[model samples]
Target: MFWDHRLTQICKENENLSKYSTYEIGGLARFVAKPRRTEDIVLLLDQAQSSGMQTVMFGMGSNLLLPDHPDPETIYISMRDHIEVMPRGDLLYVSAGTPLSMLSLFGDLSGFTDFHFTFLLPGTLGGGVYMNAKYFDNVMCDYLDTVYYIDLDAPGRGIQSIHVDDCQFAYKQSIFQHQPWFITGADLKLKTTGAAFDFERINDYLNQPLVKESIDNSSLASFYRFYRSYLSSLEQGNKPVPEAMMNVVLDRTGKNHFDYPSCGSVFKNDYTIGTPVGKLVESVGLKGTARGNAMISPVHGNVIQNRGGAKAVDVIELIKIVQEALHKSFNFVPEPELVIVK
Candidate 1:
């Protein structure tokens, strides 16, 4: 009865959790909360602690999977869509709630060039910094200055600010992943060249038909060369990669990912393995393999797709099959990147 007063102020019980994930394949979460204010988050955490309820916080649910059967006693917190952006001098102070899409655009609009690397990622700043999200050579930690958190493991429930260190990172790993702290915001350091590109013209040029690859078969080289030169000039003058260019990267990499309900990549890249697990999966001919509605993608071996009406158990089973095949055929052991929320 006591918990009802505090918790019910921001949480809803027996939520359909499938709606919250990119995979769209989760069962009901016992309770779900989206706290718009920082104080609301503190209060929720406090009440959960007092009531002895286990709470899990996630950003966009892009890289997570729920358990086959979840405990109803658990509580889920989503910081996605709770966006706020503020500038401190030449750097940026981003709320964990800010979505990556908005964050990247904000930087471009504000004439910050280096911040464009995260322009097309699928989650919020909370998950971005927590996981140290990366694209190409740039990772969140590369620009991260400090992380702000509520110390659940510490006495007095302290809000701590910690700088990034080498121990806090690995290939798709972070300290927050193993700890009980909740990240609320981050301070990032990025350099800008000063704003000078005429983005309106860039936008118009991007919308033209000649920009399409098929439009200039013989002169494709010239078009691309000019485009590259333009982008280089903008970047040198302190401007982001054009939105159209980022769109190209997005379109190129997003292949078959949005085709169905599935986490983008089921397995993490192992540095020592020397080969991408996707290529290995293909070599073993496990594509299009199925366990119920869940199956390994024919288009991409690393992806496990929910063909339709897939269950968590179905995906879990498929993962086991792939794992077994990898170990047996290639003597390679695979590790999951997804957070299975059982």
Candidate 2:
């Protein structure tokens, strides 16, 4: 009853959460608040904070692996449509709700001429900036000039802006990830890769029969391309291969677990540990492993798939199996990167 009626302006109670995430698992959110304006968001946050309900924010839901039914008392926020982008002279102003792909596409379409949108955004700009989302070698913070964030409790500052340096950006992490604040937007002073590639041409190229034949999602050809790049990275003294990526072995043997619904990668590519997490799972031979309807992807050791009607507990059980196996074999415990909530 803490939220009571204060959030009536911009909140919907018991909105189903399953459709919001890319993983497409989860129960209803007690309150799925979509505040169109800053004040609306503040008021909703205040209602939740004052009532002591747990809160979680999500964007595009590309990185989340939520439960079949989350806690009914918690508040879920979706900022996907709350904000927009703007062009102010040299700066490309980005709002948190803006999808990364939108921003990049805008940059390309706007002929920002000098700036080439390089990062492959799998989700929203807010999530990307929060985690300093990375693709291959590029990162979210690399082109950022300034970031604007809202500290829910700080009404006097309205929204505060921090320079790129002070934003504390690191590999796959940002200050926002640690700090208690919501990123509102940012100012990006971008650099271009002169003579930007024609996106339409690229799209046309992708539509080519040869290219389409080369990339069979059904057959895992795309996965193989990624795996090849990953292996090439290691061979050419490039960075270590991403553990969650489907293995080249699977590609060579024509194996793909993509038939089932999956959350792609389940764990982060942590190198501080001795062996890679995926390798540890592979070492213990947990690939193609199953728990209820949730199964560890056979082709990609780090992936966990939902084989229809899978419960969150099933995935949790599979994760525990991998963790336990790794611990038993290599004495290492892998950290889950999925945004799983009870």
Candidate 3:
């Protein structure tokens, strides 16, 4: 293959696509290439485009679902090896493939504590930037000074630099997300503090008893559902409720020993409903519901998991069922967080 000779490492006819993803469920890739350098990536893209092969660029594969039956015409490009980082004054030029968790650790070690939240996330820099990914409303776009991307549609395969404002960032979306632009790197503007930021204190805060224990146990996946449930109760004027609903969901779901597969929250919150979707899910009996190797996380109705050997179709089916149920019950449609590869 062209990639074999041109790139540092390239695998053809690989069937272990599931291992690369957090969900741990996927079919084979006809071609999976990992270029050692950025230039090699451009070369590979050019070759793929010319050959009329469909390409999917992936970072850490945190938020994607590959079909159970592989697409023979498609090639998967792994950007993990293209990791690069350069500190230019107060800004850091980071390759899209860099893991957010690693970046967080880097910041902590380098005494850049202001950006510690980036580390706790389970995504890559490119994916984060693309989604304007955020926690607590502190989004990636807020720190991005500029972004460098490859235009797949242009003649001669042009590269473009986008300013922060031009990205059109919003809740879990960016302009680059819908286009054929392949993110190369990002310029992250960070702040420095006079006193060294206390990594221990921050770690303690992140590892709070309630939050840490909930996430540590898989059964507690329903913690979000409980949170939504409690919020709903509050809205409904319910008083004297148990204070540990969140903890219960977390502890119960964490004990599940099924296949460690997930698409995170398979549904997005519907804003028009004026009430959180989690509350609606709890109202129905979908929480902790299970079907052939697939279950609507009893902890959280929105999260679906593969008990073991669950197919992408199965997850999709559960999502559809949930959407229909919600629509029938509350006249609302829940959006999926997982992007299905058709």
Candidate 4:
């Protein structure tokens, strides 16, 4: 009952989980909390622990498959509003809830092209760090200096920091995936030469009506439109738009990433298998396969899309089909990249 006094202000009952996820497929959740600060998160943890409730935390829901029926006894925490960005000497401290795409915008404005790879990348910084989210040859941990986290099993220990070198980052894998530590934020080492990093300008961009509206809705189409239009505006103004950044636009759009409701990729590529997961799906002739309204994207074999009103069960069926087919053909089931909330 720790949250009893502030229940109305801090949490919701019988909320639709769909509105919080890019997939937009979850059923109603019994309890949901949107925490805007580290203190709020700690407090929520206290409430959950005291009440003997399980806790589920996520940001943006870009790479998640929330259950159709979440446990009524669980406390679901959405970290989307817990955003903060601060400059510390040669490093930038970015909070976990900050969108990964925003870093690409910062790079565009500040003349640092390092973050260009993240352009149009879905998900929040925390999730990116959790999975070591990658694009082409670039990976998230490459730009990080230190990561700050709170041990879920030991909340009284408060915040802890870890050097990037010790994070055990690999292709789409990070130490955070194996630990119960909750990422709070990270310090990104800045490029020495760039048009001076303007914190206010970056905040101004995030405050834009379109940007706020797009991010809050959890609609991939809206997210894509805002970033694409912003980039196009820069192009029209004759500002230098990196070729790499433009290629990202073409690649994602060409694949029709935002055209439907779905998590980006269902399975991680198994490099040891000598074939990308998409190709394997294609080879098995599973492209465009559907279970209910969820279908394997005809264009991108690795992507499963919600054609319309797809349920979590529909997507899960497609996932199982792919896993079973691939295992039969290749003798190894591909590991799923999509985090299915049980």
Give TM per candidate: 0.81, 0.74, 0.78, 0.96
The best candidate by lDDT is: 4
Candidate 1 or 2, higher TM-score?
Answer: 1
RMSD of each: 8.8, 8.7, 9.4, 1.6
CA lDDT of 125 in candidate 2?
A: 75
How many steric overlaps are in each model, in order? 0, 3, 12, 0
Expressed as tens digits, the lDDT of each residue in 107-136 for candidate 2 is 434444332232223456787888787655
Residues 122-166 of candidate 3: C-alpha lDDT, one tens digit per residue: 557887888777655467887789998888775245557899999
Model 2 clash pairs are: 26-68, 27-68, 27-69
Query: In candidate 1, what are the lDDT values of residues 42-100, reduced to their tens digit?
Result: 77777777778788887667777765555788788877644445556655677787655
Give per-residue lDDT, candidate 4, residue 35: 79
Regions more than 4 Å wrong, model 2? 1-9, 111-120, 153-157, 193-261, 273-276
In the predicted model 4, the residue pairs found to clash are: none
Put the candidates in lDDT order, highest first. Answer: 4, 1, 3, 2
Model 3, position 261, has a per-residue lDDT of 56
What is candidate 2's CA lDDT for residue 176?
Answer: 88
Candidate 4: segments with Cα more than 4 A from true spot: 4-8, 191-196
* Weakest 10 consecutive residues of candidate 3 by summed lDDT: 214-223
Off by over 4 Å in 1: 1-7, 154-156, 193-244, 247-254
Per residue, candidate 4 scores C-alpha lDDT tens digits across 92-137 of 8998988899899888777778898899998999999999989988
